[model samples]
Target: MKIKEGFVLHSVGDENVVVAIGKMTKKFRGMIRLNSTGAFIFRQLEKETDEKGIIDALIAEYGIDEQTATTAATTFVSQLKDAGVLDI
Candidate 1:
């Protein structure tokens, strides 16, 4: 899956946020704040990728275990899906 078009990530001081623009604003409004992990996962989702790919990237980047990475990736993806921000 990938992030739908018109959703952009921006860094605000020490924080990160996702905002919708163009036609996306019709479907989603306001901004979603993200922590460091969420920011990383969001970057990965900017491109076309699957959950396992995200899990592997997380493991490599954070040195976390498989289960930990899986949970993190899965939860974040599910949240984005629920928020209607992902192109699944």
Candidate 2:
């Protein structure tokens, strides 16, 4: 999956957020604040990747095991899907 068009990630002050821009504003409203982990996941989703890639990324970044990374990546993907931000 990859991040869809019309949404931009930005850092305002100390907070990082993903905001809907251009035509995407019609479907999604408000900004989604991203913590460090969320930002990492977002960056990964910026490219075309599979669940294994995400799990590997998380493992490389956080040194977690496969099961833990899988759970975290799955949860992040679900959130993006629910928000209509990922072009799955």
Candidate 3:
């Protein structure tokens, strides 16, 4: 899965924001603010990846346990999906 076209991630100060652009603005409006972890996951999704890939990357990047990484990745992906931001 990947982030759909037309959505871009930008860093504002110490925060990360996702916004719709061009034709995507027709479907999605406003911005999605994300914390650092969310921004990391979003960056991973900018390319093609799956849940396991995300979990593994999260674990490697943060040195977190498997369970914690799995939970975070799953929850974040679900949120993005519900928000119509994922290509999967």
Clashing pairs in model 3, backbone N/Cα/C closer than 3 A: none
Best by TM-score: 3
Local accuracy of candidate 1 as per-residue lDDT tens digits, 60-85: 99999999999999899999999889
Candidate ranking under lDDT, highest first, comes to 3, 1, 2
Lowest summed-lDDT stretch of 10 residues in model 1? 21-30
Best of the candidates, lDDT: 3
Q: TM-score per candidate, in order?
A: 0.96, 0.90, 0.97
TM-score of 2: 0.90
How displaced is residue 46 in candidate 2, in Å? 0.7
- Regions more than 4 Å wrong, model 1: none
Worst 10 residues of 3 by lDDT: 20-29
Better of 1 and 3 by lDDT: 3
User: lDDT score of model 1?
Assistant: 0.95
- Local error of candidate 1 at residue 6 (angstroms): 0.7
**Residue ranges of candidate 3 with Cα displaced over 4 Å:** none
